[model samples]
Target: MAGRVLRPVGVITETARRLSGANLHERIGLKAPPGELKRLADTFDGMLDRMENLVGAQRRFAANAAHELRTPLAVQRAAAEIGLAGDPPPEKVARIRTRLIGVADSSEHLIESLLLLAVSEEGLEHTSPVDLAALAATELAAAEPGAGPAGPPQDPTVVRGLAPLTVAGDGTLLGHLVRNLLANAVRHNRPGGRLELSTSADGVLRVSNTGPVIDPADVPRLLEPFRRSAERRHTAGEGAGLGLSIVASIARAHGARLAAEANPGPEGGLTVRVRFPLPEGPTPAPDSIRLPRN
Candidate 1:
């Protein structure tokens, strides 16, 4: 009887000692007879599995972040090196200045995106009634001045479905979500492409853009950090591939459902829709309002 108890204890000690330096990827688990000892072994194994998953996720995130940040830094370094290499004339200095400014702008955008992503990971702390439709309109309007001739069609049409489509969430975060969506829509669109923004009484917000067709299979990967679709390759330096990922993160933080669908046609485009749960209260009247055609 004494040896029986001591034997199990001895086995547990030896198992733990052997596992101390063992590779976490091996998924090694202890073997014990049916009883409290078996339950203990199972619990230990489960913990190891969870730790492995967490470590793996952290490693991936670090790798992706390093890769994304290196581009702008490299651009900045090259610009500085070229500028200092010679006594450049006024025209050359101006050109170099412009290049540096572009690099600076890109760096600023990347930092802001990284901060937003970090905040999203922490989750939302406060919530209130927010008018997503109005927010969408405001963001779209703010984006107009930056929408150059090379961007989406000038004077893009606007179609409003439901007025005061309110959702319960952090107003600032929700604004960021809307802005990112609208920015992506305009940024990826063709010159003559059309953008449509609409909201439903059911608490659904949709932004659709007529641009390069995206593969349905690639949509999932596009939402991951630092992952971009084939269409984005040509416009590589314009963005750091965090727009949609940040949008997805904010949506998740707000407990909203986000879905991306490819447009139906050979020309190809993408529509992103986010649906939020209705707050407790009377639903607003559904009205169709269309802005004057641009």
Candidate 2:
């Protein structure tokens, strides 16, 4: 009888000692009778469940980052090899130079985004008041002059409902969060679509745009790094595909909730809302909250 109860306890400790990324799939799976030992076993297995998820996510992130980096590097190599071969003409050389510069810029952007995502996930190191309304207005104005994301149609009719809404967080990350929301609005919108921006004292910042129809089921996964719609609405040449992902990360760092939904009517787009926590305490982290598609 002494060995019986102690056996499961020993198994639990051994499992934990040997647990690693490679062995996260393993579990003690203690089959002992109901009691303290069995409960402890269940608890240990539950911890492994959470650990498996976290480790899996980190692995996926690293793989995605590698793939994102490889594309730009490949483009640069191709431009160098093909464009400079056999002493190409002056015009051709100029085109190659421009292309290389553009590729370099895109690579830089991707690297910065990857680093920012990591930092945001690690939580904020500094906290201050960040005005969502002001940031929204600034980004919208920047997007209005055809500075919107690449490959989008004519500028959308932007309507603003700005109010002085400030939240406590890292100001720089908050600014990026706002910029990404506007950029996503424009990038996914149709020609002559509407981009609506609104903020209120409740610490809510809302952005809606008209674009291609998105599946309700796909809204949640859009928050994943490098994730894109199966419809291929945004291609590899488009932005780094981190816009919504970064927004999600920043919101998480600020202890806010981020949600997105498909817009109504024939001109379909997305409506994303970020609700910041009151200064009293951090809101619980919301990994995949989204609005019902209409």
Report every candidate's CA lDDT: 0.77, 0.84
Clashing pairs in 2: 211-268
Can you give the TM-score per candidate against the true fold?
A: 0.76, 0.86
Which runs in model 1 stand beyond 4 Å of their true positions?
A: 1-24, 27-54, 145-147, 151-162, 231-237, 281-294
**lDDT per residue as tens, model 2, 110-184:** 899988988888998889887778877887777663653543456678888998988899888988998988878
RMSD after Cα superposition, model 1: 9.5
TM-score for model 1? 0.76
Superposition-based RMSD of candidate 2 using all C-alpha atoms, in angstroms? 8.9
The positional error of residue 90 in candidate 1, measured at the CA in angstroms, is 1.4
Worst 10 residues of 2 by lDDT: 229-238
In Å, residue 58's CA in model 1 sits off its true spot by: 3.2
lDDT per residue (tens digit) for residues 1-294 in model 1: 999766766765665566642455553354556887667767767877887777776677788788667877887788889775788788888888898887787778788998999898789788888888888788877875335644333544554454568888888988899898888887777655577888888888898887787888888877877776663362533477788989999999988899998888965778999988887776656565555798
